[model samples]
Target: MSFDQLASELVSRKRADLYRERRVLESPQQPEVVVDGKAYLAFCSNDYLGLANHPDLIRAFQQAADEYGVGGGASHLVSGHSFHHHALEEELADFTGRPRALLFSNGYMANMGTVNALVGKQDAVFEDRLNHASLLDAGLLSGARFQRYLHNSPESLAQKLEKTEARRKLVVTDGVFSMDGDVADMPAICHTAKVNDAWVMVDDAHGFGCIGATGAGVAEHYGLSVDDLPVLMGTLGKAFGTSGAFVAGSETLIETLIQQARTYIYTTSMPPAVAAATRASLKLVIAEQWRRELLKSLIQRFRDGCQQLGLTLMDSPTPIQPILIGDSAKAMTMSAALREQGIFITAIRPPTVPQGSARLRVTLSAAHSEAQVDRLLDALERVK
Candidate 1:
């Protein structure tokens, strides 16, 4: 089995500017980071609330590590479900305004597990055309009848929902679409789904810790309850500034997942220390309103600056602002150019984005000062 064809395919991707490489991160996640042995003002992090390196979260993790040790040791069904994990799930349930919440190792697993647990061959899944890869993969893996509607178009969703004759129909979407940074019209979607007798699930990975008044995420922003959005999923890594992911919903829904979701039942639970740190992170997420407020301000500041530069921006009110570059090779060049100027924003190209829509994915954070944003704007002016 010579991998000659595989090697040729890799070469083709590189020539087409589609090859992806991992940059070595040598420091903790923050506005300023050491990557590939050089310090850069990083603008591509998902740490929207800037709590990833918060002193309190760090201290809590260290303290918990002393008590619970490092690894999860076993699956949640075995000895790995520690006190911290149990407590965090309770806190998450309360935070999300759901009856119960179950934790998974990561967002991908959470999506895959929940979707598979809820629907099967006789059922169907409806999703946004622009859903995150995890949700799309989950729908495909569940062996359900999968269909995608136009992005954020509740009318399109309703049209599809009206025609599906599957046993169970689950409508899935991203609360805050990860790449474009635009939010889904959850109110309209929920209403349509309810009318059509379909279950609604929102993967709010980017919404948690960023949107909503008390950082309860998009559901809270829209005043939606468990009855409105039946399955709510969020990742701890983004706004919560830790790691792991969870699904919050009714007790029956959660227990169903616990029993049937192989991703959750068989995988090692997240480390108890991470659960402890996330508990601390959750406290900050709720108590520190100023963090979200600062994020709001920063997002506006960056957007305003981009507008002045006459740069094409997506309809995104979130911190994830993508500057449209359109050409994949040029987008890669622009990313490197910004890096040379000590500003780090990654070029997101196809198939992460559709063809002819390559972009410089500029993510803002509360940790960034207005001055740093200005520096990026200045660099963008030079590059563009």
Candidate 2:
């Protein structure tokens, strides 16, 4: 019963290669950040809208902290839910054009809580093979019969659904694939779900404030309504540039989660100051549409540059652009070379991505300049 040998065994097996060792970040989340006391142009953050360091958000957080105390102190079902949280939920519901919305401490909890609450032991849950780990984990924990369809293949989902004999079926997928940088085929999936009498859910964590007109996310991009894909989950920490997550859906869905979602009912609510900051982030995401435009231009610029270099890149129309390097060690080597050039793009290896398809997840932000993109391209060419 010696537990101390486990670390040695992992290191010996080289499975420790999959470990992510975070660098010490010494500044706010901006286009440029100091890591390990070295300045670098960071391309690894989910802050697509660049509002993380906005002056207005900081001021709102400061002001809210002065009014509301720092800690939430209790769970939402108790006395933790504050006016800030309530206002943000209302704003989110309105933003997503849903009847109601409920907030969770983070996107992981939001996905887990919603899926586990909606599907029971006897139900069937079908997910994309490449869906986020949180969604897959929730499906397993829900005691439902879990199945995975081929990535982005509606036909595969239909086949799986046709075989399942459960009375209730749910199909969930990531609106924007995180590591691949590609979007889910929402229209096809929704159509398949409708034809199969299955409910569809979209975790639009990367799309909420970065895709579609007014940043309404993937469903809106595909012109799907609440009736088409009823369960929508988005994270405020991504494009919103704050912390926390929300599920936007029909009134019944929200009320049911409030009552049955163990993660939502048991965990202490997020700080009101974070909610206040998220309110500011939401405002900036909507009013400052120029940010999204700038982000798009940067993405296009990088894509065009990568194409010119003949580098292997994914076909993605969002800010989460990935450069596919097939070998895990090769991807890590490329990432390290870029880091030496003061460019921070993290290497995503298995089991986050497929074994042979590890990549450098080069995410873009509105705060980054065209010159910076060009510099990244130049550095990439040198490394290539």
Candidate 3:
């Protein structure tokens, strides 16, 4: 808590090349952006289906603002639950094939609130080693006996769950590993959870608007149902191209969260206009199948190009492709070099990733053309 110690810690981080900073984005979230007064072709956004700045979404937001004003003035438990929020929740439930869906302020709050609501001191919370920070933090903050298994390994999960004697057991994972871009083995994980008498929770933040035949996400992509993968959480800010998150499950589960989840209970609901915008984006996510197809094509194109370049790529079929740079400084150098060439790709380092496994997280979107992807590849090759 002392000022001197904080300054020393900051100096240590800088010396270790682990200091982090944020860039000022002047433009809207899209493929092309202006960062710190410089124009660049950005590949770091989570706008997978290219709906972040879509005209339809903009119009819906504008119309909703005209009708409902801007803010949700109070918590959902108070007077903040607008018709727009209720309608979006219902639409999300239908979209995900769930019995009910409860909206939260964001993905982090949804994960934290859900885990804490379901588990307690006598319960057990198991998670993937490489899950999103939100999931990891939720598990720790739940005050349950938290344990993490190897990344995406059902066998590792089974080994840990078999010995758990808690009153309730919850196994959590990301539907699509956000950093690695690979998907969790949903069928295998669900089977393991069943054998251990534990429920499964999947946070499909990066999958919902880009995967499956109808963009139902990893659960639908693997043909898993509400019974197989119970507790589905997705973020609207990512693939949905809106802002907020939700948890979908049976009626009992959602109602339980509404009554017990502190995060949901205390936080103000998202703007009514944001919910309306999500409704519009949801329509495009389902009706405009071309976006998904285009994203798939772009992923394939980038992967094929990287393979030809012999770049170290993770086994990811999703839009979140990561190139392993191994060293943190090297990753940072590569990122700076790419920016110098008019491309913007962020270098992801520990403790976000494991030590000695720093990487360049190259994400794709439906908005990017094939030529743009090739340009990125060209820049990467030149940097190399």
| Full-model lDDT for every candidate | 0.95, 0.92, 0.94
For residues 3-119, could you state the per-residue lDDT of candidate 3 as single tens digits? 998999999888877899999999999988999999999999999999999999999999999999999999999999999999999999999999999999999999999999999
How close to the true structure is residue 191 of candidate 1, measured as C-alpha lDDT?
99
Range of the 10 consecutive residues with the lowest summed lDDT in candidate 3: 10-19
Q: In model 1, what is the error at residue 156, expressed in angstroms? A: 0.7
Candidate 1 lDDT, 1-384, residue by residue in tens: 899999999999999999999999999999999999999999999999999999999999999999999999999998999999999999999998999999999999999999999999999999999999999999999999999999999999999999988999999999999999999999999999999999999999999988998988999999998999999999999988899999999999999999999999989999999999999999988889998888889889889998999999999999999999999999999999999999999999999999999999999999999899999999999999
* TM-score to true structure, per model: 0.99, 0.98, 0.99
lDDT for predicted candidate 2 compared with the true structure: 0.92
**Candidate 2 residues 1-384, lDDT tens each?**
887798787685475467667689999998899999999999999989888888999999999999998999899999999999999999999998888999999999999999999998889999999999999999999999999999999999999998888988999999999888799999999999999999999999999999989998997788888999999999998889889999999989999999999999999999999999999888888899899899999999999999999998998999989999888888888999999999999999888888788889999999999999999999999998
Query: Given candidate 2, what's the lDDT at residue 316?
Result: 94
Which residue runs of candidate 2 sit more than 4 Å off their true CA positions? 13-16
RMSD of each: 0.6, 1.2, 0.8
